[model samples]
Structure formats: C-alpha cells, structure tokens
Target chain A: MKTIGKDRFGKIIDKSYFPLLVVFALVTLIPVYILVKISISEPVDVLTQHPTFLIHNFTLEHWEKVLTSGRLWPAFTKSFVVATLTAIFAIFIATPASYVISRLPKKVKYIVILTLFFTRMFPNVGIALPISVKFIRWNLMDTYTGLVLAHLIEQLPFITWILVGTFEVIPVDLEKSAMIDGASRIRSLISIVIPIATPGIAVASLFVWLNSWNEFTYALYLSLSENTLPLQVYYYVNRGGFFQTATYATILTIPVALITYALQRYLKSDYLGGAIK
Target chain B: MKKFFQKYHLEILLILPLTLYIMYFTLLPVLTTINLGFINADTNVFSLENYEYLFGRDDFRKAFSNTVIISILGLIMQLTVGLILALILKKTFKGKGFFRALILTPMGVPTIVSGVALLYIFDTQGYLNELIYRVTEGLKYIGIIASSYKFIPIDWASGGIRTLFMIVFADMWKVTPIVTLLLLAGLESISLQVYEASQIDGASKWQTFKNITLPLLKPSITMTVIIRAVDLFRIFELPMILAGKNTPVIATFAFEEYRLYNNPNISGAAATILLVIIMIFVSLYLKYIDKGEGLA
Candidate 1:
C-alpha cells in the first residue's frame, strides 16, 4: 500500500476536514440558534446596533405574552386532540390496507404503490377550497371531526405505504404457520405481526401526528372559528410582534424536535426504505 | 365458495376500512371539485367558462411560472447542499453524532417556525440587517470594499427575487437534513468491500466515488429528487408566511380566488389544472425512476 497523507478511508483524518466540519456545523446551526436567541432576548437587545448574539437581559416577556394570549390554550388543545385522533385513525385504517397491498401480485403491487404516491403530488391548498365549500354545506365545518376527516384523507396513503414496507418484510410463513397451528388469521395478525411491526407503527403514528399538527391549508378551511396551532401561529405572523411571533414559533417547535430526536433511530430504518425503493 | 373466501378473505377484510374512507372522502371530494369546475353559476348551465377565465388571468400565468421557478431553484439547492452534508457526515470522526444532531435538528423545526424565524431575520430591525450593518461598518474601517457605495440594509419581504431567495434558503435549511438522512442511508447501504478493493488497486477516493458510489447511488438520488420535486411544486406555507399570502404560487392562487374573490368555480379550474400538471409530472418521474431501476 502506498503511504500517502490523503488516502485515509472511513475517518476524515485530514486536517482540512475539521475546518469544513466546523464551518458546516456553524452554518447549519447558527440561523436556528439566532432564532432561539431572539425569542428569549429583550426587544431592545434584539433590535440594537450590535444586535447582541450574546444574551444579556434575557427575558420571558414574549413567551409570557404568547402563553397568556388566551388564544394559545384553545388552539393548542384543539390541535393536540385533532392530531392525536388523526394519527390513531390513520394508522388503524392503514394497517389492513397495507397488508392487502403487500400480498398483491408483484406487477400489480408496483402499480398500486405508484398510484398511492401520485395522490401526494397535488397541493392541499388546491383541493381544499371546493372541499371546504362542500364541508360547510354538509354542516361539517369548524368541527374536529371535519378536520380529522380531512387530515386522515391526506395521511392515510402515506401511513399505509409505510406499513406496507413493514408488512412486506415480515415472513409470511410465520403468520401462515401460526394459522396452520390453529390460531386464526386475526389472532395471528394481532398477536404476532403487529408486535413485530411496532417500530413501523411508531413511525407512521409520528408522521401522521406531525403532518396534521403542521398542516395549514385544510385547517385553514375546515376550521372556520376553531383554530389549530398552525393557524394561530399564522395569525400571529400576520398581526403579532416579532418577539411574540418568535415565542409562539418556538413553542410550536419544541415537541416536534423532541419527537424527532427520540425517533431518530427508527427514522433511518427500513420503513422509509420500503417506500423510496 | 368457502375456498374462494379462504383465499381472499383476509385481504378483503383488511382493505375494507381504507376503501370505505377513500370512497367517502377522497373520491367524493375530488369528483365534487371537478363537478364544481365544469358548471356555470351565472346562467345555471354547463360551460367551460371557469377554465377559460382561469387560463386568461394574469395572476394564473404568474402563479404557474412562479411555482415552476421556485420548484426548480429549490430542488437544485436542496440536492447539492444535502449531498455535501451527507458526504461530510459519512466520514468516521470524533464528535460525529454531535455534528449530525446539530446539522439534522432543522428537519424537525416546524415549517412555519422556519418561515417565521427567517422573516424575523429579514425584518428591517431583525438580526440579518443588523449583522449586515455591523459587518459593513467593520469593513468600512479597512477603507477597501466600502469605497463604492453606502451599505443599505435589505428588507427581505420587499417583494422580489431577494424574497424568493430568502424563502428558498429557509426551506433548504429545514429540509436539507431530510435529504441528507435519505442519502446517508443510501451511502451506508453501499458495500465497504468495494471501496477497499478500489483502494488496494490504487484508485483515488475521487475515482472510487465517481466509478463506484455514483453509479450505485443513482437510484436514491433520483428517488430523492422526484420526491422533493413533487413536494416543492406544491409549496404554500413558506411563501404564505414570508410574503403575506401572495407569493403567486398556483396553489395559493387557487386559494385567494376562493377566499378573497369568492370564486370557487375559478379556483376549482385552477386546482384542476394544477392536479393535471402534477399528475403528468408524477407519471413522468415514476417512469424515469423505474427505468433507472431497470438499468441498475
């Protein structure tokens, strides 16, 4: 083997690589760091000539306003409830649909999967207008049920495809053998298959929850007076002050970041791999 | 009869719930929109007036072009930035996890938060302009680069390409992590043995990457691009928050027609056109990816 300083594999042993890494880490992180800083800093501190990157008189005034704004609690509660219900219903419906697709003939299976993907291409903002009009006529407007229904429609195909990836990996013979041993199909599915697919279920549930929580268009329409957190955030963006908006935005970000950090492991796993391939 | 049920029973039972929901909600609404688009309200008769009106509108033309431009720009930036981050993260080094976490955290930052945060930065009194003012003042001391003109701080929401660039950057900042993760997964799946063999044969790292990794990563890259493209086409919130609901994206254009104009028929026509365009692009991408898969 030729001894050269540049031939290092796996590890970036070169001295220049460290600078690159440092610059990247800073570049990638500094904007968000600035965001959090502005949220906590006093307005005067933020708007000053030097614009203190270093927090001096760190105040919770903006956060306090966001919290006591009276609109925050109702919107948060409504969003939390709707997102939770959407996640559950989406996964519940998607499980069986995915299983059916997983067992389809190979050629037909690919086509069906493509169709599912195609459904995702259109914008919710586009379809939501007519749908909202119909919803009003059907007396489904401004209700959690209406919002959840719309969210379910958006999330079901995605969750189902994810579960399809999970289901496909599971050996058919494991469930088949159980059925042969006198455990019924439903029993085998409930006891054996689902337990094995817990990781995928989590991914699907979180994805659905996050999508519904962050979704703007459908909520914009279906919820006439009842605002979701995203809608409330948009309201603040339009009319609220910089600090107040930052505070609410930061509030919106915390749980999502926590869930993402917690779920980072399974996120890199085969569930997404199944859909992309 | 029993045998037929036995063969198809589980499949039927499983798909039933999803089938019912799709029938009731997705199909029903889509057909409703199509129906709404085709009917004329003024005459109480069927006509293509809504579609013709939509096609003739200046806003529709601007919105269509804006969507296309933003999607293309966003796609190129996201793919390049994502690949660089992915490649850097692929190396084994101390503090790798910390760096990855720092870099990847943006993917979890809510979309509106990213949008709103950038808006703060780009505000007249926000940190972005403040930083520029300070930097330019610092440079003014050197008396070199500051001789041309006085540095005027920018307002990012001034309604131009600058606003588009800022919004695109915000999107890339939040989404590059996702693309990185996807590409990193693809890179990890590559066999180390191939790299080792190439190294032993006296191939350079650049050569190995070009010859081996590039070909192998084609499928993942294509998949990622197609997925991102489809997503970028329908972007709404970023523009909405940054530019106050008037970025002229087709989706938002459709929205304003309904909400501001109270013209659901015209909105329906715009949406239908969007759906058709997306469907065309989706099929083309699917075909291209499938062909790439076949070749590989």
Candidate 2:
C-alpha cells in the first residue's frame, strides 16, 4: 500500500520485484545486443543461426569493408563537421537570445517561447523539399553549407527553448552583482552567467550535436550526390550487404552512445526541449 | 532610444543575429511551403488545385489512413509501456543507473541507424528466421521434441499491412524510452509528502495511484502523447529503410511524390497536410506545456 515517494530514484513500494527487471532488460538490451553481434560477426555467421549473438569467429572483414568503402570517410566527415558546427552555432547564438526571452515580461515571454517551441517542433522533417528548392536556387544544394543551414532550421529553435530554461535558472542577483561591481553587461554574461549555466548548455549542446548528426530527412532533401553519415548508412543498407550495413550502423552509433553515456548526468528527465517550468 | 539601447543592449546583441537566421531558414521556408502548396508554377495563380489533386489520389488516401492508423497504434504502445516502465524505474533498485542508461541508449543512436539495425533482424532471410529455424533444429538434435513438431519462418517484408506494422514496431523500439523518461520525470516531480499523507490515511496502492499518480501525471501524459503522436505521424526513415520507398506513409508519400513523381504541387499539398496534422498536436502540446503545472 506504499505510494511512490520522492527519494531521487523516486520510490519502491513492494518487497518483491523480478518481472519488471526482466522486461526492462529484454526491451532495452536484446535488440542492441543483436545489432552489435551482427555487426562484428562474419557474413556467413550473420545469415545462419548456429553462432548468432556469440561469436565463434571474430573477423575484421566487415569493418574493413566499411573502412575501405570510400563513401564512409566522406560521410563521417560530413556528419561530424555539420554536427559540430551546428552545435557550436546553436549554443553561441541561441543561448543569449534565450536568456533575453527568459528575462522578458511573462505574457511576452510565453508568446515568444511558445512560438519558438512550435517552430522547433513542426518543420524540420516536413518542409524538406520546399526548402531544398529554395536552397537549390541559391546554388546551396548538395553543399556542406546547405546541409548546415537546413539542419540549423531544425536544431536552433529546440535548443533555444532548452537554453532558455537553462538561463532562467541563473538568478538575476548573480549577474546584477557583477554589473554593480562595474563589470559591463557582456562581461557579466561571460563571467557570471555562462559559467553557472554550463551544465544546461552542455546538455543542450549534446542534444543539438546528436540531432544534427543523426538527422536524415533534411540531409536527404538537401544533399544529392554526397551523403552524410546517416544517409550513407541508408545507402549501404539499401544495397543489401548485411554485415557491412551493420558495421556502418555500429560506427554511426558508437559516438552517440558514448556521448549519451558520458553526458548522461546532465540529461534532465523532462520534455527534451526544456518544455517545463 | 539611446537610453533604451543602453539598458537592453546586451539582450539585443544576443537575440538579433539568431533571430534573423531563424527568419531566413525557418520562417521564409514556411511561407514558401504555404505559397507552393496553393500556387500553380506556370499559371502563377493560387488555388486549391493541389489540395484537390491530393485528395483525389488513391495513394494519398492510403497514406493518410495509414498515417492515422500507425500514429494511433504507436501512441498507445508508447504511453502504456512508458508509464509502466517509468513506474518500475521510479523505484530504487540494484543496478538502477545502468538500467536507466540502457533503456535510453536508443535515444542517442541515429534513427536511420536504428532502422538499419532492425532491418537486419526483420528481413526475410535475416537473423529472426534463422533463429527460429535453428531453435527447432536444436530441439530436434537434443531429442527433446517429437518428430512431428515443425517451425516455419515469417517473411516479414513481403509488403502489406504487416510491413507497416513492422515499421511501427521499429519506431516503438527506438522511441518508447523517451516516453518512459518523460513520465519518470513527472513522477519524480510528485512530492514524497503527498504520498506519505495518503499513506497515513490508509489508502491502498491502487486507490492512491488512481487518485494521486494519475491525476498528477496528466500534463506529462498529455505532453508525451502529443509529442510522440506527431513524431510517429512524421515518420520517414523507418519505413524508408525497412519497407523501401514504395510504402506510402505520409512522410515518405510526400517524399515519393516529390522525388519520384517530380510533382511539386502534390508534394507541397502533402507536406501541407502533414503540417496541419502536426500543428493540431503542437497546439495540444502547447496547452499542456503552458499550464506549466504539477507534471514538470
């Protein structure tokens, strides 16, 4: 009869708990384990059932195939460059704007913030072709800059909301005291506000990087002959080489997995866009 | 004006550049889409012809219905499984941190990569059937089975409603964790004091959950449902990677219309419909997030 009470993990009511753990493990781990095993397994082993999930023979052949595929490095470079640039710009440009919006009067603030949320949520995937045509007219299509601009449309608005939440939590007194001590507004922002807001900024940056890195629909529209990491993975899978496809999938996944795990501490358990009070 | 600039100069410098960038990329594109959806390119006349053409097509009708069906099904699984998992996770347990990370690992993986991963599993001659075939063979080899028992493998990608279902499953695998994490935060925001007060009054677990947890979780519930529903509606890569371009879900349908058919009006019209559908969910989502109330 004990209710869920807050203790950080939140609550534990019953003395006996076995079933939920099993379900959790199966749902969370099984598919990933299968994917990893397939990626490293030999091509024959992948298609056959005998040595599945446990490697009888480990081979770097599939890894070699992906490494030498010629498309892989370019794809990797494209994704990394686009994603890193997107993260840097989103954090630098959006965070200050977010702080300003957060400082506004409540009615104007809600309107502005809500407008940001709507823009962030709605368009990135849906507006691909219309925007692609626009990019093409600018002769921006299929270029790295084109992809970045397309992705910024997707990345900036969402992280702006996230950073706004981040900035709102830094108290006015901290920055005010810095200003009162004759620090200029910009100096106070750099010296006082940014340092305190580091954690939220990091989480927001991780989000922007991951979103830009993994995004597909915009990359599909914006680029044609050249592929980003995600689109290249799709191309390989489309061509039907199981182990090679899995190898690329693994490569695509590793950084994201590392980033999520390393930055795990900062991810607040709310709406991802900081869609909360 | 100079005084005002002096007062808010920092905010202005901060906000202005990014605002212009957003206007160029997002706002301008949005206007162009609305424009393209209505106007004929050659005639330069705005009309409902694109929408009319879209609604008249059989494939568009199919895509619309399929989008509706998949969204509803995916939404149900996400909310139910998410709530249950969040409840399990809210409790303290052994290896809790590890388990939390494991559940959320999918969030970090590129959605396209997840599509590839699941395709490797679900393909006709893929690991799934191989596993099924070998399991029965192993039983036969061990002599624990009668000779009469047989197993046949499923051809999952044979292109039907089942293929659509497979895409839905793939999406659920990738996305359900997000919903769980959202609800977990909502549960975390509920105070220990409330539960303790209820306990003092001797409410049973089910009664307390119904009275306290459910009502308290409404905003999170609404937020998760709308977010996940719109996300599911806009699904592209899962079907594209798993089922190929022929599968006519709304997103891919729009893609096929533009890329394969080379018809901008039809694609624009389809994209506009998707925009309307998403806005409905966005409006609902804004209502809940705006309440900014108990659910965090």
Candidate 3:
C-alpha cells in the first residue's frame, strides 16, 4: 500500500511536469512572438480594437520601409563599428593582462580580480556623464573613438574577468612544456595557450560586441548626432507609430538573435558559473 | 633597474596598458563625478548647493524614493520568479535543453528592445488588452459574467503604480532568465550523491530540499541579489522609454538634469548618490561572500 502510494505520487509528478514547463516556455516566448508578429502584421489587422494573436494579414512593407528609409544603414554602421572596435580593443588589451593575472600569486590575484569586479558593477549613468563631459572638452564628442573608449570602460573589466577565468582553466603545463622546448614565454602563450583559449576569447568578444551594440546611455550623452542602432530604435519608440517602431526594433534585435543562436551551445551554466566567484 | 626590466619586461608590457587604461578612464571618471557633485557650477567653489537644490526639488525626492522602492520590489519579483524557474529547470525532463535555451533567449534581447516590445504589449490598444478582451468575451459566452460586461483597456504607461508595475514586469521579462541561469549553475554544482544519501536516510523530498538544497544555493542567491540589485538601482531605459518624465528614477533624474535642465552639478550629485549606494552594497557583498579565499 505504501509502495503504491509512492508510485502514484511519482506518476502524478511525471504527468504534470512536461505540461507545466511548456506553459512556462510559452510565457517566456510569447512576447517575442508578439513583437515579431506585429512587425510583419498589416496595419488593419493590428491597429484595431481587437488585435488577434494569429497573423491574419502578413506583410513585409514595414521591413522594406525600414531598409529603404536611409536611417537604418547609418545607425547600423555606427553600432557595428563601435561594437566591433570595442570587441577588438577589449580582447587585445584584456587577454595579456588576464593571462598574467591568472598566473599571479593568490592574494595579489584576488585584489586585482576584486578591482575588476567592482568596476564592472559600476552604474553606467554614474560614469557616462563625466566621460561625456570630458570628451566634449577634448573635442572627442560624436566621434567613434569617444564612444569606443566609453564602451571599453565597461567591457575591459568584464572581458578581463572572464578571460582570467578562462586562462585559469588552461593548464600552465602546456605553456611550460613549450617553454622547455626552447620556445619563449611569449611564444608559448601565443602559439599554445591562446589557441586553446580561443573559444573563451570568442565568447567574451561576442558579449562585448553585443553590449556595445545595445548600449544607449553613453551614446545618448556622447553620440548626439550619430545615433547608434539602439538610439535609433529609441527614437522611433518615442515618436514613431507602432508598426515602424516594431520594424526598427526587429531590425535591432536580428543580430542579437543570431549571435544568441550561435551561442546556444555555450550558454550552459558552466560558462557563466564563474561570474560571482 | 635594467636587470629588473629585462626580467619582467613581457609582464609589464602586457599588463601596463590595461591598468593604465582602467585608471585613466574608469577610475578618473568616478573621481571626477564625485568631485563635480560637491562643487558649485556657477562659482567653482566646493559646496553642498547641488545636494541642497536636488533635495529641495519635488521630482528629485520622488525619483530618490522611486528608485529605492523599485529596486527592492523588482529584486523580490525577479528573484522569486527566477528561483521558481530555476527550480523547475533543475529537474530532468524531456526537451529540457530546448526549453532552457528558449527561456534564456530574452537575455540577448537589448534593453531598449525589451522596453519597446513591452510597450507594444502593454499599450492601451496593445496585445495584452486584446488578450483580455478576447478572454472576457469567451467567458461571457460561457455565462461567467454579465452579457453587457466590457473589458476596460488599461493605459499601462500612465504614471504611478501602474507604470511601476509595467517597469518591474518588463525587467522581470528580460532579467529573470539571467538569475535562472546563475541559480541553475549553483544547483548543478551540488553532487547527486548527496541527494541519494538523503533519500537513503528516509528523508522526505521537502525535508531533503530544506536541509540540503537551500543551504548550498545560498551563494548563488547572494550573487544574483547583488548583481540584480546594482542593475535595478540604475534602472534607466525602461522608465525613460515607457513613462518618460511621468516616472523618474535616479538615473533618469540625472539624465534630465544634465540634458534637459543643463544642471550638471545636480546631475553629478544624483550620480554620486547612486555610486555611494552601490558602493555600500558591494562592500556588504565582499564582506559576506569573499571570506578571504573565495575568489582564489
């Protein structure tokens, strides 16, 4: 009788678990679905008293308008350039520092890591104002250099922290073996350790790019005239109609979606597990 | 000196650039903002006039309280929802990976896009209201309410509790996935042997969870709280895009002072205040979690 009761309980759980998860998944995804639906939705279908969840009249006219509108390309280019440059510069500066820090003595490593973590947690608005003010005085305002520098303030510490973790996982024996075989320390790092750390570097760089691409506070303060893609989306959100805003927002999200899709395999908990520690 | 340089030249060359860059950009700006907060913009003399002025303003006070209220409320909401989701995802089930990936997709969506998408849903003539209307109509057909009953579409962007709800809801939609991911990592780190042992000892499921899972999950919970607290304190884009001036948080308040009012002193003061609060939180986190060797 007790065994039967336990089996019944287990059976009840088994019966309910999948459906419960399905509901949760649907709730999580319905917003994105609605956004995408609205973007392709015809005006008559969406701009009404009762907008159906199902797309009754599908059209790409909004997408076409956004493409040909002349605003999309410039904003896209600026965001792309800023994000790409931020990623490249971040990886270049952070990699070596991370490698060295990963090999540092424990106490010293803790302090350095703490400093990076502290800076990473800084409020963006807190620094953005001063940086923009300084950039204005230096005549760096509205320039890609200014924006990239501002982005680096946030990305550098983050990339360094992640890369430090990445480097810690790489056995020092590989580099030591190469060094013993007459390779210099630099050569070993370059030819051996770095190759093994490529995946980590790629993930960090992609995240930096995504962050810079989506950044708005610094862009709002610094890039007054040349808006980034997020700023462009914000502009439409403030003033444009529903369809246009949806279209622009969809365009802004496309690359993010693509990158996230590419990153699905690496989105496991282990990659982000070191975030606190 | 020459011998020392020769010995560690690679290390110095590799590490100096980042150290200098961080000191110049990140550290300098923080110091400058703090400095700017105290100085009088008109006289260039150090004073508390900026703070005085900000404190005297109605909107600034509203923003200050709003920031605190939203941070606490939003943190609770996100943590609860995220914990539930994480607990559910921790269980082994079919298509678990697909569901996990799907749920986490929102993390990649930009904050601005989140605001826009949520606005699309919560706007008066938006999808949410439409959903309500359809559901109510269906219910009316089933004799659940008066046949003449009509659903009143809520203008979710309007200021006050409604706007606050929208902002917190939107934040949850975007950020809860991150908290879930972090907690899942913590959960996965716990070995299966412990659970098996608990079962062998004849502990009930709830007893095992209470005695084992909760204790082990504390670190991840602490980390998520700290991270989310910092982010929530600086809540900006959602409030700015959704309710505009009608709802003001500290970050938005700072932006308004700098841009709309051209009062950099007031803006600097607001920013400095936020920085101080965040510093307190960080220090508390360090003291609690980093009992010397955690990072190492």
Candidate 4:
C-alpha cells in the first residue's frame, strides 16, 4: 500500500465522508451496547451500578430465569405456529392472486396493482378492531385461524404485489410455449412460472414470514388465551419483569436477528428494485 | 371483448381468493366501520352520535393531534437521517457491507422486541440512567451540568411530549434503514455520467446533489414517505406497548376506545375517520405518481 502525507490523507478521508461514517457507526452501535449492558447486568446492579460499555461482572442468571420460566417457551411455540401458518396461508392465497394479476389485460393489471397499493397504505388499526371483535363474537378468538387470518391481511398484499413484479419481468414466451404444449394454467404456474419466480417468491415470503412473526398488536388483542412470543415480551415489559429477565429478551432477539440476516439480501434486493428507476 | 376476456380468465381466477380476502378485510370492514360510526350505542339506531362525540370531544382531539405530530416528526426524522445514511453509504467505504447489514437488522426484529429494548434503556434504573450517572460523575470532576444537582427523574414512556419524542426516535431507528436502502437505490439509478457532466459545467457537490439528485429522487422519495407515513400512522403495538393508551395514536386510540373504554361506536368513528384520511392520501398519491409516470 502507498502511504500519502498525513495532511493529504486527512483531507481525502474528510472529503470521502469519514465524519458521516463515524456518525452512522455511533448511532447504530449505541443501542446495541446499551442492550448488551442491560441484558447481562444483575437486576440488583441494574439499578445501582452505572451501565457500562463493558460489564464489570457477567452473569447468566437473567437468561437462566427466562429459560426456567414455563411461560416463555409456550409463547415462543405459539409465535412459531402463527408465523408458519401465516406464511403458508399467505403463499397459498397470494400465489394465485399474483398469477391472475400478471395474466390480466393491461388495464385490469393496473387496477389490481392499484388495489394492492391501496391495501398497503390502509392502516391495520382501521379494520383490526372490527376483525378482532368479529372473531371474538364468532368464538374464533384465541384460535390459530384468527391470528393467521389477521396476519394474512397484511401479508397477502405484499406477497402478491411483489410476486406480480417478479412475474411481470418473466418473458411471456416461456409460459406461452408451455401453454401451447397443453400445460394447464395451474401446471404452467407450478412447473413453469414458480421456478422462474423463486427469487421474488423468496423475497416476498421472507417479508410475510417476518411480518407474521413480529406481529404483536392483533395477537395481543385476539389471543387472550394463547400469547405469541412478542405479546409475551410486551407483557414481560408491562408487568415490569424484563428487569428480572433481560437475558431471555436478548436471547429472544437472536433468532429474529439471525433470520433477518438470512433474509436481508432478499429485502435489500426488493427495496432496490422498487426504489430505483 | 370476448377474446380479451378469454385470454385473462385464468388469471382472474387466480385473483379470486385475494380479491375476496381484501374485500372481507379491507373494503367490507371499512364500510361497516363507517356505518358503525353513525349509530348510537344505547338506541342501536343511526344517529351520527359517534361522529358528534368525536367532533365534540377533547380526548379524540388529543389523539388526532398527537398522532399527526408523531407521524410528521417521525417522517422528518426518518427522511433526514435516512438521506444522510444513504448519501454516506452510497460511496465506497470500509465495512460498507457490514454497516448495511447492521442497519437493517433492527427492521426484522419484532416491534415488541424493540419496544422492550427501548424500555430497558429509558426506564428509571435503565441503561440511560447508568450512562447519565457516569457522565455526571465525569462532569463533576470537570465542572459542568451542576455536579450537585440530581438529574430530574422523568418517566420516558408516558404519552407526554418526551414519550412522543421517544416514539419518533424508535420509529426512526426501526425504519430509517429501509428509507436509506430505498434512497440509496434511487441514488444508484442516477448515472454517474450526469454528475460528471454537471461537474464539468462547474457545478459544486451541493449543486449537483440539489439539481440533479433531488429531482430524479422525488418520485421514489415521495412514494417511500407516503407508504411509511401510512404504515406508521396505523402503528398499534409499539406505541401501545411502549407508551400505553396514554399516547393516543389513531390506531391505538381505536384499540383503547374499544378495549378499555368499551365504546365500540366511538372506536368505530375514530377508525372511520382515520380510514378516510388514509384513503385520501392513497388516492392523492396514486394521482401524483401516475402524473409523473404518465400512467394517469
């Protein structure tokens, strides 16, 4: 490596946004530092000792408490079930919707696309109340169906819209050739279209999956008997028990963080596609 | 017409479930909610009482005002910081990939997880206080911020101005990466040749950014802002979990009206009003975006 004079290097670095890099790094890292510090600290020390960037004493007691606690595991199981079911439900409903939207006439395609767009913008709170109350009245409250349906409301639009984008990019000729060879529309979608659109499907499924997993409000409102992990986490905080169990909360974040990391590339690509000209 | 219909019939069949689902969840609920808003609870008769209650109420007014303030402030914060992040990360840098990954990790973590994390930091005995104590001790040795004065204990999670600020901050943390990612994509689409041409014409960095970058970015930026605004406006769990019913967002307000207040008509009215605002924004955005793309 060639070394430049100190002043020259300084100027170059400044010009190239050394300051901005530092700011972003600080902004991003501070919360993580705070979280780690709080998580490992003893509940007694959490109050008395000033939170440090480096822990003076480390303990897994909080993690122990969270693990040994019976309620935590059940909630985690519930969240997993809800998220998985929502993903399956969303894919089932959205795949067909995406196919139809992509196959429609140009005008109809535009209309359907517009509908999806509007659905995305419409706030969940607007309908969530009625839906939850309806579920309650229908005795679907605390049921997997209710949670799955609620998640579908958010997941369906995104999955279908993103899938539509994927399908639109595919040349019509491939599917046309398949159709001409006597493959049915369903067959063409399954054998021809889906394989070609796997990347987009991956991106959309990741989004729907993450949305379903992270969903808390509707779960909290609907599942009076069965709480998802997020709802339990909320209750943990509300009940002033996070201090008693910060390690579990930190541990809880690990799976989500890992899955998110796995899905980050897809999300990045999707955002890039939508945001770019 | 027959040929057109035949060609698309299969496609339309696929759309059926989604159409039905959206109708049931989106359109039907909204219509029913609006109808619900017009009825009185005691009489179970149409009376516009719910709307009158909202219009004549202080709590409803507070909720609306607070929601707007949080949305506007949060939007501005997200855009400003997100733009900075995008601009910085657009160029070559060491650990660029690492930073990008780090930035978006929070987005995938559940909202309640984040809310829980914030509570740990902002709680009285939380990390923030610990940091404050350390800083105060250092300040005492150096002579600043009154070494003798105990820092005022303020509950950060209350729906007061401070909690609203935190809500905006949490929202920014959760979403700025997304905006940054989007804006970076927008920035990348602009050819470097255009920038070089502008530079050749003696344009400054700021000038090329303002003239070339901003105009091209308008469409993406507008869409990003509008989409995020609508989504955040409907925010339920974060505010409710973090700030509780004290902080009245439009979404949580409805939840409170129904859950805590036990007034479905009032909740329906509030939800209906919020729904109308969102629809207006969506239609306006559709119109505006189409004008730019010539889709209209």
Give the top-scoring candidate (TM-score): 3
Candidate order (DockQ): 3, 1, 2, 4
- For model 4, fnat equals 0.51
Which stretches in model 1 have alpha-carbon errors above 4 Å? A1-16, A48-50, A269-274, B1-6, B44-46, B147-149, B285-296
**Best by DockQ, which number?**
3
- Candidate 3: give the clashing pairs: none
lDDT, candidate 1, equals 0.79
Which stretch of 10 consecutive residues in model 3 chain A shows the poorest summed lDDT? A1-10
Question: Candidate 2 vs candidate 3: which has greater lDDT?
Answer: 3
> What is each predicted model's overall lDDT from 0 to 1?
0.79, 0.79, 0.85, 0.74
Cα lDDT tens digits, model 3, B28-117, are 888888888999999999999999998999999989888888888898899887887887898987788888888888977888898888
Worst 10 residues of 1 chain B by lDDT: B287-296
Q: State the lDDT of candidate 1 residue by residue for A1-277, as single tens digits.
A: 4533456653453556678778877877777787788889987787665577778889988888778879789989988999999999998899878888987888888887877776666667655876798789889998888899899988988888888888889999999999999999899989989899897888779978988888888998788688888888888788856677777777788888888888877666334423444
Task: Estimate the TM-score for candidate 4.
Answer: 0.91
Clashing pairs in 2: A11-B91
What is the per-residue lDDT of model 2 for residues A1-277, given as tens digits with 9 covering 90 to 100?
3333432222344643446657766766666777778877776676654446577677888788778978799889999999999899888788889889878987888888767766765545456777877778999877888888788887888888887777777899998999999998889988998899898888888888998999899998888888898888888777877777788888989999888878776666543635655
Ranking 1 against 2 by DockQ, winner: 1
Q: Which CAPRI tier for candidate 3?
A: medium
- CAPRI band of model 4? acceptable
RMSD of 3: 2.5
lDDT, candidate 1, residue B163?
Answer: 72
For all predictions in the order shown, the interface RMSD in Å is 3.1, 4.1, 2.5, 4.7
